[model samples]
Target: MKVLRRWTAALSALSLLVVALPASAAPATRWEPCPVAGSAERQECATLTVPLDHRDPHGRKIDLRISRIPAKGTSRGALVIIPGGPGNSGLNRPSTVNFPAEIRESFDLIGFDPRGVGQSSPVSCGMAAADARRLTPWPGPDGDISENIATAKRMSEACARNGGDVLRHISTRNEARDIDEIRKALGRSKISYWGLSYGTYVGATYATLFPQRTDRVVLDSSDDPDPRRVARGWLANYAVGFEDRFPDFARWAADPANPLRLADSPDAVRPLFLDLAAKLDRAPQDWPGAVPPKLNGNALRETLLRGLSTDAGFPLLARTMAAARDGSPAPVPVLPPDAVLQNISAVAAATICQDVTWPRDIDRIARDVQRNRARYPLTAGMPANAGICSSWPHQPAERPVEVTSHGPANVLLVQNRRDVATPLSGAWKLREAFGRRAVMVTVDAGGHGSYLATGNACGDTTVTKYLLGGARPAHDLHC
Candidate 1:
């Protein structure tokens, strides 16, 4: 990822009160057991009743599905796992992600499906399955976004027409409010949080709005929260991210002894992959049983970019590239199951469009596409173009909260040097915004999800220290 480093002084003037909150009021409704399919012994589930709209708290309510794994020892506080995807469900994460035993001993590990996601009152734009499948317009061979614009318009219109009133409320500000409600429901005055990917934004928003209620915050794979350019900034970041991380893939693919090696030399791999993508663009090769079944340029590029998100996915890219080059049809990884896809699409679009205003002018997007294509050929121009936000029907529910240094000095950001999803360049923007309120641990590794997944000991230790004990490094640390 492109590393854009900047720093600023911390703001400490805001005299926020850290008052003890009262116990949760007895709900007019009763709670129910919302259990996962298996692993019933280690975890327990419950539903928390929160208002559909915080402004009208006494009005209609929605149920937020929450899961908890009690601490082994006396608990210091509760640690909430804020899952990413804006649409992801954290209800199952505690068991799957293997919550740290030491941290779990000191705190009750909590996870939940955010409002309008998962077991929480889910919302769908009600798009036709076929339309929804084709809605994500993969950019053309030359990086033209004319088709993407059309797709965005159609998608936005479909969502507006079919999505109910709940769809209008799927913004990040609302999600933050939902977090506050969750806190109230959990009977905690302050909470420690672990947020990943877009969850980092939600966690930051919570800290910004209710800093006094935040005991500790760990923003992993941090994202730039510049309100003026939200997802636009995220999209543009891929240009730099792909450039930074692609070399790692190249080195892996070029290693001679590696069974999945695609090229003889690291330098030769990039152009070779590019050539294959271009060849497929002109004449798509058939892949049996794969969705759409044809290997097109955008599909190849999307596959490559998605694979770069983590180390586990590296060999998949290498194998796919090798097969494509040999003219043998390679199987595409199965897309997430339909229910999962629907939930994720809804949350991703809602959080992104809710957080900021997108440029409505097609000419602006056309210009961006032209520039991004010229600068970064690997991702083509998809990273620079507009998404469903371009045609969103409703205005953003609230102004995007500017993440400032006004909060407590309890945030610790961990980032990988080359993260394709949330790149180092964006991480710097976040670091600048947080000022002295945060100390970033920049790992010398590649891929996303820095602390546990990136395989960097220094970065992991820095974050673990902060989480287990309230310790902060004297200055910004580079590992």
Candidate 2:
């Protein structure tokens, strides 16, 4: 969701005009087994050499790392999983997230690290850890953004000084081109895709660029497709998302049966959280081992936001909220391994900065911060402010591609009603953009990922039916 804006710019440009890259079947450059432990049998790795600049197909090349998990039985087609971060590498998907056996047996699962991410030709803005930490300020007290502007400037300077030529090429349009090249390299006339979060943007770009080449495409947690307000729009949506999803957390926290309960009832939970956050904002508490050094209002909010990504994360939110209410600062939860965080952050930044040109006008952001802070106190002003993209040097190489009914009617969009990240409102907008070309399933559940992560039987069954039997709902359906 945070990364959606960058791709939105690329998609917008694409929608305004069409830039064609000739399609050609190319041979794989280098093929090897993935080195990640426990992935040897299920995953194989390869390098795909594509032109650094698509306009000059015969020019210098950049390599994309590709991974595949072969189908157990006969294959229906190859299902490519596009990782969300413009910077996210899909190279390890074969070993991480579990795939339904039926789908796995029918399709070869493919994943790739988009250029400048993961095992592909990696790029770094070379930001110091300290400077990078400050780049995105936690939403300020009352959602003010005076601090965010300063952070944006510092981050931009670090990138301008350290990010090399590769950073300039990290736009979403280029990534779409990279996907087409991957398709050609794989010898597939059409490709199936399951894109999550920012991956939805990539999938949309591919569909726009090569509609004939798209097979079964599922965009989970869909985003606002408007090019002009890509990431910016997403940031604002946190206000509604938090409002919609927080009730779930509140319900769990206030339940008497739950050991993690923090309030007498769900109605009491919201105020409790708001009060604690305000208390923390006035007096920062020490929590050793937490990132950013101490437990503060913004950190608590960040945790709450991250926790809303999945249902399993609800407990953490409850526990954290409970501890905070008791006045005993809890340690920041351990994150994934450092290497994983490094890779994730790298991919996220590259994709975001490359996709769009953030507003250079600090005043506009400041105003937005003020407005957002007033309306969405929970997220503060952090969601509305500029990120590394504000300081990004280059304009998007290509505009965002508009998704329309021009493509084949092969897309299935599944969304949770209360997703804190992507949010339901954005998903509705995506469905509208697709027009009659898509059928959406709105699940009566919460959290980010919907089809699998949301525990709604109807929602999962509907998606599974489509994926396995190519059956789509008659119209936009609700479960």
Candidate 3:
């Protein structure tokens, strides 16, 4: 009687499985000839409709502008490229960014504008560039919080008034769901992801929730996947991150061979920078039409921060510094176009504000800023300072995804030794969460993203070997 009962149960499971399988999968994306100038490889563009709110799948929908460069031959699967910047779009990575063409040719290079970014249904907070510049995560030069607090509230209000319901739904979880929807739309069961900077957090969240759906995952220049930190932590780390990455710039600037040499020695570079900033703070350059309309000390500081993001930016910083010191007409500052800035700021603010609640208390923020200044003067207490999120109108729609090591063993983390934005320390925290599941390739280089830029040949080779040939180092390998 017992054997008969077990057989009946097993037969019932088989019957359910047979009935559950779909006769045919969802329709594949229709391919078209997309001729983009300056692109040597064949590329195509299309849109996939995803829910604005995943909770109501049948409700309103938004188009995700997805681009793909199909493989030259038989493909492994779709290699989705996730761009950095909570505001950055992946839509141009395959063709625009300097991703290795050899690896790109091995698989379908897929890029998409995450919900409110790029060619997708973009959202704007209607913020002027001037207003955006004033609202800093960093406090004022003297650690004054009055303006910072006001800006925070004003910025939050601007977002609340300008960014509507769609803003509330732009969390990492929703983005991950959208990714799965893209997978379904493309008729793929699994996908390989290559995420940079903030995209690392997004990719990690996707892996946490849909482990089985991930393949050949590469998190380059990772953020602290800490639920409490989220964007808050990334914002705060600018101070520390700049400190870590600036030294590399200093050494390069000190090199006499460089046309835009700053100082005689690496030691002189640091003090020269500090002195220049202080002098400028007292009296800004008379340049017009720049971000602040005058090249102030903070403007120089901000340029330094961006310059240190990668090794390629070293010259920009040195030349700018040289020109400023020489009292030459300041080079025209090139900020993103107005429309692009609006879209980016809206997405960045909404994502930060909606992901989790930042401290609303001004006193605590002020104190943190004070401490931050004393400890790290490069950013002058900005990282610890409050911004728009402090006074965000709505509550978080969902909890931050807790990244764990429970996912498939296909995760690979490639990091630079001294990245200012996503430092090695934070990457270690992410590595700890993933435990043995992720094998890290720490390159002995100083830049934000490791796979291609600023990374040594070994690091790029390792990542390419993994993405193309499905090979991962047996252990954490330092290149």
Candidate 4:
């Protein structure tokens, strides 16, 4: 009776939108072998055909590449694993993720490449490798964003010239729509989900748009779903995120016993890093084969941000920092293939820009940068500065979807307390938006991802229990 009531209510809400459906009931997704070496041999692949524009569902169609690993025994249901990066590939996730035996046996693990990413009707900005590497929009020396503004304008024009029609439709809302299509194609009435980073936003949007269809949901490393800001807020969060997480790195780097120690104490690490950055700003060191072939202040800052994602990267970061301080040749920057970088850059720009319009007022952006730089010296003003979205070619076709507490109380948000990408502050906002519909488990850990990644027994067990038995705590938990 409860299920029927929820379903009816969801149908009534969906009726407000032009629900895209095929002319005739579409057949169940046919799977074919697409195995990943050294992993699951039974991993199957398939393609989903969805509309280019949800409003014009019948107008044009695009393909989404999907992959799945079937449940071991009698399946409980399907669990879609949505990866991070408005730009990361998801097709190999089912085989790659180290799921517990129970989870592997209980659910058919599924993953998909969102439109304009990976093998799903890929789009490109035709960006040079160097431009793609510098997508984060680092401010010039003296906190000037003139170069950042020019880069934004140039990148925006490049995308407009090369990104085609699909670029315009690549957005969080549409990704939610596509996930619904995936659900329909699977012939499931409801689907379980595990979403990481930006995927958490997509999952939140889906749960909002189609509440009844959501079963067990675990959102890891959540983003702030502020309708007015969205991606802009996520970028700006790096300032707070860096501040929250850098202390962990500093503590690790300052240990006397550690071979890569940069400072004698944690208190000294911050000044040392700032001094190195200032020195680099005045004189960048040349590397033989890096993108720009120079280790500048911005590049060092970028490296620190990446290094803060996980504690495991601390050694390499310490080595790099030590070399920079010692006036030695910097390590070569590791980068993905040029083609992959272009795809990521295009999709990231399209998604961020199309999801919502960024503030275009140069004066306001510059002022924000100055203020942000003053408050958070570690991340500089990069987080608050303008990017390609500032000069986006088209305004969003619709306003950003607001995640609310109207959905069924089925969400379990598990987050690390100090994440360098998605900090606890933003996670709290997402949790507040979900209200009665969600219960967040705050892990007393540092880094980007929580759950199995963090090895927090309480956090992992809580999520696994929800996934398997549909159980949740009466209130928010501090694991």
Candidate 5:
């Protein structure tokens, strides 16, 4: 899940499986050239219709946009590419992402826009642009959440008013079911998977629900798969994740050769950033072309959240911080189209909110925020603050899927030690949940995704070897 201002930031299960139709009764998928420009000639697009509610297999149906890049050599099977964000589109990944030649040649790479995303029957809350920016409940400069509570109520009401039945049915468990449908459509009983960020959870859920159907599974940058906490835990992790990842940026920002250097030493960097954020809270700088049109403390924090995801983004973040600290002309923040944001916000709200129940008591939530603010000043308690889910009109369609070590030992977990979004601590929880069923490779690196990212040769080699050949270290390995 990508960072959004305030609270909106961005699940799994199995029975269980949905009843399948006879092979002759199932619709035959016809693959045609993808409509996206610059898409590779090898890539083809198709649509698979899935039940809106898996329980009611014979009821209303929705289409999922899927893409595939056939193998270069004799294919072993399919490798499904799952994108992050309960909202991110995966249909173009088969063409956009550069996979190693060996892996691409060994299997047919597949991608899809999960239900309620992209061309897969998208949903919206009909929220005004301003309301969308208020998705996260960042407190006032004085640590007051009065406005945050009000914003939550408004956003919740808007979603209930505008989001249709599609929003109600959007969930992690359903997504796993959809993947199973894709497997059936492709005429494969078992498939390999490569999932990133939130996609890791989707992959885990698929593996748990259909353990027998998963061949080789790779979960990169995992989320804590605690069914009780669910998305709330992911949100709260930002407080610790930011602290863990900040030092890496601090080292880069304090380097003498860096043009955007903010301090003389790494130790001075944290104080500098905290002071700058406090100053922004008191007086926001005008930032044209950005959502809310101002560079406030939370806006700066959002920049940190995104920038810490990759080393390539460090300079952009440094530049933004330098501008804020010096009161220089604010860099114009590029934003996605309003329609895109609307769709993402709606899907994020629905999936996170309906995955599990949240505290409806404003006072209970307020206490949590206050405590979080005191302990972790960098995030300013936003991670602990309640969002639209607290006031969400609907309840979860089913219980959150508990991912246990009940499946095959085919799972491989790869992680960055200091990922800001999905931190190592949270990944550990997932690792423990998988138990002996999964082998973890923790890279001594920073940023979010790990495999082929962060340039850790050992981590990359371990994951590649696992995908190419079914080999994993006898125990959890640290690179």
Candidate 6:
């Protein structure tokens, strides 16, 4: 009876939007083998055609590339997988993620390329290689944002010229709408969701907008659902997030068994890194093959942020840090060529700027940077720094989604304790937003991504059980 009530209410909200019929949009026979390797051979691929603007159902259309690994056993429905990176091609997830046996047995593991990403109607701003460096979100070492400000304006203008109308529509809300369109195309009245990173924000918004349509939603590594801040806030929180995650790196770097020991004790590691960055700021080094080929303070800081995502990245960061200190050549990680970044940077800029308005006032931002630098020396005010969003071409399309607990209690929220990207504090904010509608599982783990990435048996098992058997804990549980 309770499920019926929820279903009815969901259909009521969904009625406001035009729902595609399966036979017309996609046929079961349309499934073809996916092109990516390592994925199960039976995995099928398809394209979903959706409107560029949800407001005009009969307008310009875009194709969303999608893939699915069919269930080998009893099926509940489709478990739509939302990938991270407002820029990731979800269609390729099966190639990397080894979905556990239970989920594979119970539901069709599905993925898709959100609009304006890989294989979809892709967009790029044509930003130069040099422009990418000048427009990094972090301010100059001396808190000078003048160059960053000018570069951002040029980048924003390029995107406006190159991106056209697509830029305005690449937002979380539209992404959620695209998900619903996929759900309808699959002939499912209700569907389950497993979203990670930015995907979590996408899942939460989907639940709030179409509660009845949601079944067994799992939001891993969540961000704060504060409507006002959006992606701008996520960039700023890097200061706090990095401080929380860097210690784990320090301990690992200082370990006796570790080949790359940067310090004698974990306590020594923080100062050692800070000193290294300061020295690099004063005297930059040249690496013939690196992205900029010149290692400066900002590059080191960027490297630190990069390494804190997972412990797997620790050794790489440490080795590079040591090489920079000793003036020895390090195998600097190659960034994806500028051509790829053009697509990535444009999508990132569009989704963030179109989702919420960023303050364009340089004076105010510079003051904040200095204040942030003083408070969090480890991150050096990079978190509070501005990016191209400050000079974004247009105002936000709509207000940011205010996530509420008014939806069905079908959510399982998973979070890591020491995430440098989506910190537990931010996850707690999302948990609070979900209210009575969700049960959270706080994993006693570190790193940015939880679930399989953390390798926490307790966290993964708890989530997998609920996903496989639609049973959630009565209250929030700690692993």
Query: Can you give the TM-score per candidate against the true fold?
Result: 0.91, 0.90, 0.92, 0.94, 0.93, 0.93
Of candidate 5, the 10-residue stretch with the lowest lDDT total is 3-12
Top model number, lDDT:
4
Candidate closer to the true structure by lDDT (higher is better), 3 or 6: 6
- Candidate 2's residue-wise lDDT over 329-437, tens digit each? 6847876554555445555665666565567787787787888777877877777786766766567776666778797889899898999988899989888888877
Native-vs-model 2 lDDT? 0.74
**Model 6 residue 410 CA deviation in Å:** 0.7
Against the true structure, candidate 4 reaches a TM-score of 0.94
Candidates arranged by lDDT, highest first? 4, 5, 6, 3, 1, 2
| Residues 1-479 of candidate 1: C-alpha lDDT, one tens digit per residue | 11111100010111122123222221211234445566543766667666677777767677677777667887777788999876888887766665556876787777889987877878777655544665344577777777777778877887788767677778788888888766655556688899998889888889899998998899998888888987778777878889999999989888998888877899999999899899999988898877767877777887897789887788888777876788887857878776667667766777788778888898888888888788888887778777788887877877888999997898988888989889988988988888888988899988888867866778887877788888989898999
Show where candidate 1 strays beyond 4 Å. 1-41, 130-137
| Candidate-wise lDDT, in order | 0.77, 0.74, 0.79, 0.87, 0.85, 0.81
Worst 10 residues of 4 by lDDT: 1-10
lDDT of 5 by residue, 1-479 (tens): 11111110000121112123222122346677775577554778777777889998767778888888888887778899988987888998888877888988888888999899988999999887887867667787857888887888889898999999999999999999999878776656688999999999999999999999999999999999999989999999988899999999999999999877889999998888888889999999998777778999988888888788889888888888888988886666566788998988899888899889988998888888889999999899999998888889999989999999997899999999999999999999999999989999999999989998888999999998999999988999999
Misplaced by over 4 Å in model 6 are: 1-29, 133-136
lDDT by residue for model 6 over 359-473, one digit each (tens)?
9888899999899999999888777777898888898878999999897889999999899988888989999999999898998877888888788998999899999888898
- Report lDDT (Cα) of residue 188, candidate 3: 62
Task: Give residue 120's lDDT in candidate 1 (0 to 100).
Answer: 82
Model 2 lowest lDDT segment of ten: 1-10
In candidate 3, which residue pairs clash? 138-382
Error of 2 at 376 (Å): 1.4
What CA RMSD would you report for each candidate? 7.3, 6.5, 7.1, 5.5, 6.4, 5.2
In candidate 1, clashing pairs total: 0
Off by over 4 Å in 2: 1-31, 35-41, 134-137, 142-144, 336-343
lDDT, model 2, position 120:
75
